[model samples]
Target: MTTEPAADPQAGKSWSVEVYRFDPERSVKGHLVSYRVPRLEKMTVLDALAYIQRYHDRSLAFRYACRLGMCGTCTVMVNDIPRWACRTSIERLGGETIRITPLRFLPVLKDVLVDYAPFFAKYRAAEAYFVPGEERAEIAPISPKSRERRAIDPNLECITCGACYASCTMLAHDAEYLGPAALNRAFTLIRDSRDGARAERLAAVGGEHGCWRCHSLFNCTEVCPKHLSPTRAITGLKRSIVLDRLRSRLR
Candidate 1:
Protein backbone atom coordinates (compact mmCIF):
# COMPACT_ATOMS: atom_id res chain seq x y z
CA MET A 1 0.00 0.00 0.00
CA THR A 2 1.14 3.55 -0.77
CA THR A 3 1.14 6.35 1.78
CA GLU A 4 -1.04 9.11 0.40
CA PRO A 5 0.81 12.42 0.43
CA ALA A 6 -0.80 15.39 2.15
CA ALA A 7 -2.82 17.46 -0.30
CA ASP A 8 -5.88 19.70 -0.16
CA PRO A 9 -8.82 17.35 0.48
CA GLN A 10 -10.82 19.02 -2.22
CA ALA A 11 -12.80 16.63 -4.37
CA GLY A 12 -12.74 17.40 -8.09
CA LYS A 13 -12.64 15.72 -11.50
CA SER A 14 -9.15 14.48 -10.80
CA TRP A 15 -7.34 11.24 -10.17
CA SER A 16 -4.70 10.53 -7.55
CA VAL A 17 -1.47 8.96 -8.76
CA GLU A 18 1.26 7.62 -6.54
CA VAL A 19 4.70 7.51 -8.13
CA TYR A 20 7.70 5.96 -6.43
CA ARG A 21 10.57 8.44 -5.93
CA PHE A 22 14.17 7.73 -4.97
CA ASP A 23 17.58 9.28 -5.39
CA PRO A 24 20.47 6.91 -4.84
CA GLU A 25 22.66 9.88 -3.85
CA ARG A 26 20.20 11.17 -1.24
CA SER A 27 17.64 8.61 -0.13
CA VAL A 28 18.25 5.09 1.12
CA LYS A 29 14.54 4.15 0.92
CA GLY A 30 12.16 5.22 -1.81
CA HIS A 31 8.84 6.80 -0.92
CA LEU A 32 5.55 7.27 -2.73
CA VAL A 33 4.83 10.79 -3.96
CA SER A 34 1.24 11.57 -4.80
CA TYR A 35 -0.07 13.85 -7.54
CA ARG A 36 -3.58 15.13 -8.17
CA VAL A 37 -4.41 15.23 -11.87
CA PRO A 38 -7.39 16.26 -13.99
CA ARG A 39 -9.15 13.23 -15.37
CA LEU A 40 -9.29 13.26 -19.15
CA GLU A 41 -11.08 10.92 -21.52
CA LYS A 42 -8.87 8.09 -22.84
CA MET A 43 -6.04 9.36 -20.68
CA THR A 44 -3.34 6.82 -20.18
CA VAL A 45 -1.19 6.26 -17.08
CA LEU A 46 1.73 7.65 -19.09
CA ASP A 47 -0.40 10.68 -19.87
CA ALA A 48 -0.95 11.16 -16.14
CA LEU A 49 2.81 11.07 -15.47
CA ALA A 50 3.38 13.58 -18.25
CA TYR A 51 0.67 15.82 -16.89
CA ILE A 52 2.27 15.64 -13.49
CA GLN A 53 5.63 16.51 -15.02
CA ARG A 54 4.35 19.43 -17.08
CA TYR A 55 1.85 21.04 -14.67
CA HIS A 56 2.64 19.52 -11.31
CA ASP A 57 6.35 18.68 -11.05
CA ARG A 58 8.98 18.81 -13.76
CA SER A 59 11.45 16.88 -11.61
CA LEU A 60 9.33 13.71 -11.89
CA ALA A 61 11.20 11.14 -13.98
CA PHE A 62 10.02 8.24 -16.14
CA ARG A 63 10.95 6.67 -19.46
CA TYR A 64 8.89 6.70 -22.69
CA ALA A 65 9.54 6.46 -26.41
CA CYS A 66 7.47 6.02 -29.60
CA ARG A 67 4.47 7.22 -27.49
CA LEU A 68 2.91 4.08 -28.88
CA GLY A 69 2.72 0.49 -27.67
CA MET A 70 5.67 -0.58 -29.85
CA CYS A 71 8.52 0.53 -27.60
CA GLY A 72 8.49 -1.27 -24.28
CA THR A 73 10.54 1.45 -22.51
CA CYS A 74 7.49 3.00 -20.84
CA THR A 75 6.73 -0.07 -18.73
CA VAL A 76 5.97 0.40 -15.02
CA MET A 77 4.16 -1.32 -12.20
CA VAL A 78 0.50 -0.29 -12.32
CA ASN A 79 -1.36 -1.52 -9.27
CA ASP A 80 1.39 -4.10 -8.67
CA ILE A 81 1.34 -5.30 -12.27
CA PRO A 82 3.99 -4.60 -14.91
CA ARG A 83 2.44 -2.69 -17.80
CA TRP A 84 3.34 -0.27 -20.54
CA ALA A 85 2.37 3.14 -19.23
CA CYS A 86 1.98 4.64 -22.67
CA ARG A 87 -0.70 2.14 -23.62
CA THR A 88 -2.37 1.59 -20.26
CA SER A 89 -5.44 3.78 -20.01
CA ILE A 90 -6.20 5.14 -16.56
CA GLU A 91 -9.91 4.50 -17.02
CA ARG A 92 -9.21 0.90 -17.94
CA LEU A 93 -7.55 0.27 -14.60
CA GLY A 94 -10.85 1.29 -12.89
CA GLY A 95 -9.50 3.12 -9.86
CA GLU A 96 -9.59 6.66 -8.59
CA THR A 97 -6.02 6.14 -7.39
CA ILE A 98 -3.16 4.48 -9.26
CA ARG A 99 0.10 3.29 -7.76
CA ILE A 100 3.02 3.48 -10.15
CA THR A 101 6.45 2.18 -9.32
CA PRO A 102 9.65 1.21 -11.07
CA LEU A 103 9.78 -2.33 -12.43
CA ARG A 104 10.55 -4.89 -9.74
CA PHE A 105 13.74 -6.88 -9.18
CA LEU A 106 15.93 -4.01 -10.39
CA PRO A 107 17.68 -1.16 -8.64
CA VAL A 108 15.90 2.16 -8.87
CA LEU A 109 18.14 5.06 -9.84
CA LYS A 110 15.50 7.70 -9.53
CA ASP A 111 11.74 8.15 -9.86
CA VAL A 112 10.49 5.30 -12.04
CA LEU A 113 13.94 4.87 -13.60
CA VAL A 114 15.62 1.58 -12.70
CA ASP A 115 19.18 0.63 -13.54
CA TYR A 116 19.07 -1.85 -16.47
CA ALA A 117 22.78 -2.69 -16.39
CA PRO A 118 22.41 -5.86 -14.35
CA PHE A 119 19.51 -6.93 -16.56
CA PHE A 120 21.48 -6.47 -19.79
CA ALA A 121 24.54 -8.01 -18.17
CA LYS A 122 22.76 -11.34 -18.19
CA TYR A 123 22.57 -11.12 -22.01
CA ARG A 124 26.35 -11.18 -22.19
CA ALA A 125 26.57 -13.93 -19.59
CA ALA A 126 24.26 -15.99 -21.76
CA GLU A 127 26.21 -14.99 -24.91
CA ALA A 128 22.97 -13.84 -26.50
CA TYR A 129 24.35 -12.99 -29.91
CA PHE A 130 23.96 -14.16 -33.47
CA VAL A 131 27.23 -15.75 -34.51
CA PRO A 132 27.60 -15.64 -38.29
CA GLY A 133 28.27 -18.74 -40.31
CA GLU A 134 31.97 -19.64 -40.51
CA GLU A 135 32.20 -19.99 -44.29
CA ARG A 136 29.47 -17.67 -45.46
CA ALA A 137 30.42 -16.72 -48.97
CA GLU A 138 26.72 -16.06 -49.62
CA ILE A 139 23.58 -15.75 -47.53
CA ALA A 140 22.13 -19.06 -46.49
CA PRO A 141 18.74 -19.70 -48.02
CA ILE A 142 16.02 -20.04 -45.40
CA SER A 143 12.45 -20.73 -46.37
CA PRO A 144 9.52 -18.92 -44.80
CA LYS A 145 8.05 -22.36 -44.26
CA SER A 146 11.22 -23.78 -42.77
CA ARG A 147 10.83 -25.54 -39.45
CA GLU A 148 13.79 -23.67 -37.94
CA ARG A 149 12.38 -20.29 -38.93
CA ARG A 150 8.88 -21.18 -37.74
CA ALA A 151 10.18 -22.49 -34.44
CA ILE A 152 11.72 -19.08 -33.67
CA ASP A 153 9.10 -16.74 -35.15
CA PRO A 154 7.15 -16.31 -31.91
CA ASN A 155 10.20 -15.42 -29.79
CA LEU A 156 11.62 -12.77 -32.17
CA GLU A 157 9.33 -10.09 -30.75
CA CYS A 158 11.25 -9.41 -27.54
CA ILE A 159 12.29 -5.76 -27.10
CA THR A 160 14.38 -6.59 -24.03
CA CYS A 161 12.32 -4.13 -21.95
CA GLY A 162 12.96 -6.21 -18.79
CA ALA A 163 9.23 -6.41 -18.10
CA CYS A 164 9.56 -10.17 -17.94
CA TYR A 165 12.78 -9.81 -16.00
CA ALA A 166 11.10 -7.59 -13.44
CA SER A 167 8.14 -9.96 -13.24
CA CYS A 168 10.43 -12.96 -12.81
CA THR A 169 10.36 -14.29 -9.24
CA MET A 170 13.32 -16.52 -10.05
CA LEU A 171 15.62 -13.49 -10.39
CA ALA A 172 14.61 -12.31 -6.90
CA HIS A 173 15.85 -15.68 -5.63
CA ASP A 174 18.64 -16.77 -7.99
CA ALA A 175 21.00 -13.92 -8.81
CA GLU A 176 23.03 -16.08 -11.19
CA TYR A 177 20.06 -17.26 -13.22
CA LEU A 178 20.10 -16.05 -16.85
CA GLY A 179 16.33 -15.35 -16.61
CA PRO A 180 13.94 -15.41 -19.58
CA ALA A 181 15.05 -12.88 -22.17
CA ALA A 182 18.62 -14.13 -22.55
CA LEU A 183 17.48 -17.73 -22.59
CA ASN A 184 14.76 -16.89 -25.14
CA ARG A 185 17.35 -15.14 -27.33
CA ALA A 186 19.57 -18.19 -27.02
CA PHE A 187 16.65 -20.42 -27.97
CA THR A 188 16.05 -18.35 -31.13
CA LEU A 189 19.73 -18.63 -32.07
CA ILE A 190 19.74 -22.35 -31.45
CA ARG A 191 16.70 -22.71 -33.72
CA ASP A 192 18.05 -20.41 -36.43
CA SER A 193 19.31 -22.30 -39.45
CA ARG A 194 21.95 -19.68 -40.29
CA ASP A 195 23.51 -19.56 -36.83
CA GLY A 196 26.83 -21.42 -36.80
CA ALA A 197 27.38 -21.37 -33.05
CA ARG A 198 24.57 -23.76 -32.14
CA ALA A 199 26.76 -25.85 -29.83
CA GLU A 200 28.23 -22.79 -28.12
CA ARG A 201 24.80 -21.13 -27.86
CA LEU A 202 23.33 -24.34 -26.52
CA ALA A 203 26.13 -24.60 -23.97
CA ALA A 204 25.55 -21.02 -22.94
CA VAL A 205 21.88 -21.70 -22.09
CA GLY A 206 22.01 -25.31 -20.93
CA GLY A 207 23.72 -25.16 -17.54
CA GLU A 208 22.71 -24.37 -13.95
CA HIS A 209 22.52 -20.64 -14.48
CA GLY A 210 20.78 -20.97 -17.82
CA CYS A 211 17.42 -22.35 -18.93
CA TRP A 212 17.51 -24.91 -16.14
CA ARG A 213 16.70 -22.17 -13.63
CA CYS A 214 13.26 -21.41 -15.02
CA HIS A 215 10.40 -22.51 -12.74
CA SER A 216 7.69 -22.63 -15.45
CA LEU A 217 5.68 -19.95 -13.66
CA PHE A 218 4.99 -18.27 -17.03
CA ASN A 219 5.27 -14.85 -15.40
CA CYS A 220 7.50 -13.85 -18.30
CA THR A 221 4.76 -14.73 -20.75
CA GLU A 222 2.11 -12.95 -18.69
CA VAL A 223 3.97 -9.62 -18.58
CA CYS A 224 5.20 -9.66 -22.17
CA PRO A 225 3.68 -6.76 -24.09
CA LYS A 226 4.49 -8.41 -27.40
CA HIS A 227 2.69 -11.58 -26.25
CA LEU A 228 5.88 -13.56 -26.74
CA SER A 229 6.33 -16.68 -24.65
CA PRO A 230 9.78 -16.93 -23.09
CA THR A 231 8.57 -19.88 -21.04
CA ARG A 232 7.89 -21.83 -24.23
CA ALA A 233 11.31 -20.87 -25.53
CA ILE A 234 12.95 -21.98 -22.30
CA THR A 235 11.11 -25.26 -22.50
CA GLY A 236 12.36 -25.64 -26.04
CA LEU A 237 15.92 -25.21 -24.81
CA LYS A 238 15.39 -27.89 -22.19
CA ARG A 239 13.99 -30.23 -24.81
CA SER A 240 16.94 -29.53 -27.10
CA ILE A 241 19.36 -30.27 -24.29
CA VAL A 242 17.65 -33.58 -23.57
CA LEU A 243 17.53 -34.53 -27.26
CA ASP A 244 21.21 -33.64 -27.68
CA ARG A 245 22.14 -35.83 -24.72
CA LEU A 246 20.11 -38.70 -26.14
CA ARG A 247 21.86 -38.28 -29.52
CA SER A 248 25.27 -38.25 -27.83
CA ARG A 249 24.42 -41.44 -26.00
CA LEU A 250 23.26 -43.10 -29.22
CA ARG A 251 26.40 -42.07 -31.09
Candidate 2:
Protein backbone atom coordinates (compact mmCIF):
# COMPACT_ATOMS: atom_id res chain seq x y z
CA MET A 1 0.00 0.00 0.00
CA THR A 2 1.40 3.40 -1.00
CA THR A 3 0.81 6.10 1.56
CA GLU A 4 0.47 9.63 0.23
CA PRO A 5 2.38 12.41 1.98
CA ALA A 6 0.37 14.55 4.38
CA ALA A 7 -1.12 17.73 2.93
CA ASP A 8 1.29 20.59 3.37
CA PRO A 9 -0.32 23.97 3.77
CA GLN A 10 3.06 25.64 3.27
CA ALA A 11 3.87 23.71 0.10
CA GLY A 12 4.29 26.06 -2.86
CA LYS A 13 2.19 23.97 -5.23
CA SER A 14 -1.18 24.21 -6.93
CA TRP A 15 -3.06 22.47 -9.75
CA SER A 16 -6.08 23.53 -11.77
CA VAL A 17 -8.48 20.63 -12.29
CA GLU A 18 -11.61 20.67 -14.40
CA VAL A 19 -14.08 18.26 -12.78
CA TYR A 20 -17.43 17.19 -14.22
CA ARG A 21 -20.07 18.02 -11.62
CA PHE A 22 -23.55 16.51 -11.45
CA ASP A 23 -26.07 16.15 -8.64
CA PRO A 24 -29.39 14.45 -9.30
CA GLU A 25 -31.13 16.26 -6.45
CA ARG A 26 -29.50 19.65 -6.98
CA SER A 27 -30.03 20.17 -10.71
CA VAL A 28 -31.40 18.39 -13.73
CA LYS A 29 -28.12 19.04 -15.51
CA GLY A 30 -24.34 18.77 -15.10
CA HIS A 31 -21.29 20.81 -16.02
CA LEU A 32 -17.55 21.13 -15.43
CA VAL A 33 -16.23 22.92 -12.35
CA SER A 34 -12.64 24.04 -11.81
CA TYR A 35 -10.83 23.36 -8.56
CA ARG A 36 -7.36 24.42 -7.49
CA VAL A 37 -5.59 21.87 -5.31
CA PRO A 38 -2.24 21.76 -3.57
CA ARG A 39 0.21 19.63 -5.52
CA LEU A 40 2.41 16.97 -3.99
CA GLU A 41 4.89 14.57 -5.56
CA LYS A 42 3.50 11.12 -6.50
CA MET A 43 -0.06 12.33 -5.87
CA THR A 44 -2.67 10.60 -8.01
CA VAL A 45 -5.88 11.86 -9.60
CA LEU A 46 -7.89 9.95 -7.00
CA ASP A 47 -6.01 11.83 -4.33
CA ALA A 48 -6.80 15.15 -6.00
CA LEU A 49 -10.51 14.29 -6.17
CA ALA A 50 -10.52 13.18 -2.55
CA TYR A 51 -8.82 16.38 -1.46
CA ILE A 52 -11.39 18.52 -3.24
CA GLN A 53 -14.26 16.48 -1.81
CA ARG A 54 -12.88 16.84 1.71
CA TYR A 55 -11.78 20.46 1.64
CA HIS A 56 -13.12 22.53 -1.25
CA ASP A 57 -16.49 20.79 -1.73
CA ARG A 58 -18.28 18.14 0.27
CA SER A 59 -20.86 17.26 -2.39
CA LEU A 60 -18.59 15.80 -5.09
CA ALA A 61 -19.35 12.14 -5.81
CA PHE A 62 -17.38 9.36 -7.52
CA ARG A 63 -16.80 5.62 -7.27
CA TYR A 64 -13.58 4.05 -5.94
CA ALA A 65 -12.63 0.88 -4.11
CA CYS A 66 -9.25 -0.74 -3.42
CA ARG A 67 -7.42 2.47 -4.33
CA LEU A 68 -4.37 0.46 -5.37
CA GLY A 69 -6.00 -0.25 -8.80
CA MET A 70 -6.97 -3.88 -8.08
CA CYS A 71 -10.76 -3.32 -8.01
CA GLY A 72 -10.79 -1.12 -11.15
CA THR A 73 -13.60 1.00 -9.67
CA CYS A 74 -11.66 4.26 -9.99
CA THR A 75 -11.65 4.08 -13.77
CA VAL A 76 -12.48 7.33 -15.61
CA MET A 77 -11.59 9.41 -18.63
CA VAL A 78 -8.60 11.57 -17.87
CA ASN A 79 -8.11 14.01 -20.75
CA ASP A 80 -10.30 11.77 -22.94
CA ILE A 81 -8.29 8.59 -22.19
CA PRO A 82 -9.53 5.79 -19.95
CA ARG A 83 -7.24 5.24 -16.94
CA TRP A 84 -7.31 4.12 -13.34
CA ALA A 85 -7.17 7.24 -11.19
CA CYS A 86 -5.18 5.55 -8.45
CA ARG A 87 -2.43 4.59 -10.87
CA THR A 88 -2.12 7.93 -12.70
CA SER A 89 0.38 10.25 -11.14
CA ILE A 90 -0.35 13.97 -11.18
CA GLU A 91 3.26 14.74 -12.13
CA ARG A 92 2.96 12.72 -15.33
CA LEU A 93 0.03 14.81 -16.55
CA GLY A 94 2.55 17.16 -18.30
CA GLY A 95 0.57 20.27 -17.39
CA GLU A 96 -1.02 22.01 -14.46
CA THR A 97 -4.46 21.87 -16.07
CA ILE A 98 -6.36 18.61 -15.70
CA ARG A 99 -9.60 17.69 -17.45
CA ILE A 100 -11.74 14.97 -15.96
CA THR A 101 -14.88 13.40 -17.37
CA PRO A 102 -17.13 10.42 -16.78
CA LEU A 103 -16.34 7.30 -18.80
CA ARG A 104 -17.84 7.24 -22.26
CA PHE A 105 -20.52 4.74 -23.42
CA LEU A 106 -22.31 4.63 -20.07
CA PRO A 107 -24.99 6.58 -18.26
CA VAL A 108 -23.62 9.19 -15.93
CA LEU A 109 -24.95 8.71 -12.44
CA LYS A 110 -23.32 11.76 -10.86
CA ASP A 111 -20.06 13.61 -11.41
CA VAL A 112 -17.50 11.09 -12.65
CA LEU A 113 -19.54 8.06 -11.63
CA VAL A 114 -21.32 6.26 -14.46
CA ASP A 115 -24.04 3.63 -14.07
CA TYR A 116 -22.51 0.15 -14.59
CA ALA A 117 -25.81 -1.78 -14.71
CA PRO A 118 -25.89 -1.95 -18.49
CA PHE A 119 -22.27 -3.12 -18.65
CA PHE A 120 -22.83 -5.98 -16.18
CA ALA A 121 -26.23 -6.76 -17.74
CA LYS A 122 -24.46 -7.56 -21.00
CA TYR A 123 -22.15 -9.89 -19.07
CA ARG A 124 -25.16 -11.85 -17.84
CA ALA A 125 -26.74 -11.85 -21.30
CA ALA A 126 -23.55 -13.35 -22.77
CA GLU A 127 -23.73 -16.16 -20.18
CA ALA A 128 -20.17 -15.38 -19.08
CA TYR A 129 -19.80 -18.24 -16.62
CA PHE A 130 -17.91 -21.49 -16.28
CA VAL A 131 -20.11 -24.59 -16.54
CA PRO A 132 -18.89 -27.89 -15.14
CA GLY A 133 -19.61 -31.31 -16.73
CA GLU A 134 -21.54 -34.21 -15.12
CA GLU A 135 -18.27 -36.13 -14.69
CA ARG A 136 -17.05 -33.70 -12.09
CA ALA A 137 -16.26 -36.41 -9.55
CA GLU A 138 -13.70 -37.83 -11.92
CA ILE A 139 -10.75 -35.48 -11.73
CA ALA A 140 -9.95 -34.87 -15.35
CA PRO A 141 -6.47 -33.49 -15.91
CA ILE A 142 -5.78 -30.95 -18.61
CA SER A 143 -2.20 -30.23 -19.59
CA PRO A 144 -1.11 -26.59 -19.31
CA LYS A 145 0.69 -26.93 -22.63
CA SER A 146 -2.57 -27.71 -24.44
CA ARG A 147 -3.49 -25.18 -27.12
CA GLU A 148 -6.88 -24.36 -25.58
CA ARG A 149 -5.41 -23.75 -22.13
CA ARG A 150 -2.59 -21.64 -23.53
CA ALA A 151 -5.06 -19.60 -25.56
CA ILE A 152 -7.15 -18.67 -22.53
CA ASP A 153 -4.20 -17.72 -20.31
CA PRO A 154 -4.39 -13.97 -21.01
CA ASN A 155 -8.19 -13.82 -21.10
CA LEU A 156 -8.53 -15.13 -17.53
CA GLU A 157 -7.12 -11.97 -15.89
CA CYS A 158 -10.08 -9.68 -16.60
CA ILE A 159 -11.28 -7.62 -13.64
CA THR A 160 -14.48 -6.50 -15.42
CA CYS A 161 -13.85 -2.85 -14.48
CA GLY A 162 -15.60 -1.59 -17.65
CA ALA A 163 -12.47 0.25 -18.85
CA CYS A 164 -12.44 -1.58 -22.19
CA TYR A 165 -16.19 -1.17 -22.52
CA ALA A 166 -15.87 2.53 -21.82
CA SER A 167 -13.12 2.94 -24.41
CA CYS A 168 -14.83 0.77 -27.04
CA THR A 169 -16.24 2.53 -30.11
CA MET A 170 -18.60 -0.38 -30.82
CA LEU A 171 -20.60 0.37 -27.69
CA ALA A 172 -20.58 4.05 -28.63
CA HIS A 173 -22.62 3.31 -31.75
CA ASP A 174 -24.61 0.20 -30.80
CA ALA A 175 -25.66 -0.30 -27.20
CA GLU A 176 -26.66 -3.93 -27.79
CA TYR A 177 -23.16 -4.94 -28.84
CA LEU A 178 -21.59 -7.35 -26.35
CA GLY A 179 -18.42 -5.53 -25.22
CA PRO A 180 -14.98 -7.10 -25.28
CA ALA A 181 -14.81 -8.29 -21.68
CA ALA A 182 -18.01 -10.34 -21.92
CA LEU A 183 -16.98 -11.75 -25.29
CA ASN A 184 -13.57 -12.59 -23.87
CA ARG A 185 -15.11 -14.44 -20.95
CA ALA A 186 -17.39 -16.29 -23.34
CA PHE A 187 -14.39 -17.35 -25.42
CA THR A 188 -12.62 -18.66 -22.32
CA LEU A 189 -15.52 -20.95 -21.51
CA ILE A 190 -15.91 -21.98 -25.12
CA ARG A 191 -12.34 -23.34 -25.05
CA ASP A 192 -12.58 -24.99 -21.64
CA SER A 193 -12.69 -28.81 -21.71
CA ARG A 194 -14.83 -28.95 -18.56
CA ASP A 195 -17.57 -26.75 -19.96
CA GLY A 196 -20.78 -28.42 -21.29
CA ALA A 197 -22.33 -25.13 -22.45
CA ARG A 198 -20.28 -24.56 -25.60
CA ALA A 199 -23.13 -24.96 -28.07
CA GLU A 200 -25.50 -22.82 -26.01
CA ARG A 201 -22.79 -20.22 -25.51
CA LEU A 202 -22.12 -20.16 -29.26
CA ALA A 203 -25.80 -19.61 -29.92
CA ALA A 204 -25.83 -16.70 -27.48
CA VAL A 205 -22.87 -14.92 -29.14
CA GLY A 206 -23.20 -16.00 -32.79
CA GLY A 207 -25.57 -13.25 -33.89
CA GLU A 208 -25.00 -10.01 -35.82
CA HIS A 209 -24.49 -8.12 -32.59
CA GLY A 210 -22.45 -10.85 -31.00
CA CYS A 211 -18.83 -11.83 -31.69
CA TRP A 212 -19.13 -10.55 -35.26
CA ARG A 213 -19.57 -6.97 -34.08
CA CYS A 214 -15.95 -6.52 -33.04
CA HIS A 215 -14.20 -4.27 -35.60
CA SER A 216 -10.69 -5.27 -34.48
CA LEU A 217 -9.96 -1.73 -33.27
CA PHE A 218 -7.78 -3.09 -30.43
CA ASN A 219 -8.98 -0.25 -28.23
CA CYS A 220 -9.94 -2.75 -25.53
CA THR A 221 -6.44 -4.11 -25.59
CA GLU A 222 -4.98 -0.63 -25.42
CA VAL A 223 -6.84 0.48 -22.28
CA CYS A 224 -7.01 -2.69 -20.20
CA PRO A 225 -5.43 -2.00 -16.78
CA LYS A 226 -4.43 -5.60 -16.19
CA HIS A 227 -2.92 -5.62 -19.72
CA LEU A 228 -5.29 -8.46 -20.73
CA SER A 229 -6.19 -8.40 -24.39
CA PRO A 230 -9.91 -9.00 -24.81
CA THR A 231 -9.51 -8.31 -28.52
CA ARG A 232 -7.29 -11.41 -28.84
CA ALA A 233 -9.84 -13.54 -27.03
CA ILE A 234 -12.60 -12.24 -29.28
CA THR A 235 -10.54 -13.07 -32.37
CA GLY A 236 -9.93 -16.56 -31.07
CA LEU A 237 -13.69 -16.98 -30.58
CA LYS A 238 -14.32 -15.93 -34.17
CA ARG A 239 -11.79 -18.45 -35.42
CA SER A 240 -13.34 -21.20 -33.30
CA ILE A 241 -16.81 -20.40 -34.60
CA VAL A 242 -15.67 -20.24 -38.23
CA LEU A 243 -13.84 -23.56 -37.95
CA ASP A 244 -16.89 -25.18 -36.38
CA ARG A 245 -19.12 -23.86 -39.16
CA LEU A 246 -16.73 -25.11 -41.80
CA ARG A 247 -16.53 -28.54 -40.15
CA SER A 248 -20.33 -28.76 -40.13
CA ARG A 249 -20.47 -27.89 -43.86
CA LEU A 250 -17.86 -30.58 -44.60
CA ARG A 251 -19.91 -33.19 -42.67
In the range 74-183, model 2's lDDT, one tens digit per residue, is 98899888889999998898787898899988899999999988888887888878778666667887788899788788988777788899889998778999899899
- Report clashes for each candidate as comma-separated counts: 0, 0
The TM-score of predicted model 1 comes to: 0.92
State which candidate has the highest TM-score: 1
* TM values, all candidates: 0.92, 0.90
lDDT (C-alpha) at residue 175 in model 2:
90
Model 1 Cα lDDT, one tens digit per residue, 54-113 = 998888889998888877888899998899899889988887899999998877878998
Candidate 1 residue 117 C-alpha distance from true site, Å? 1.2
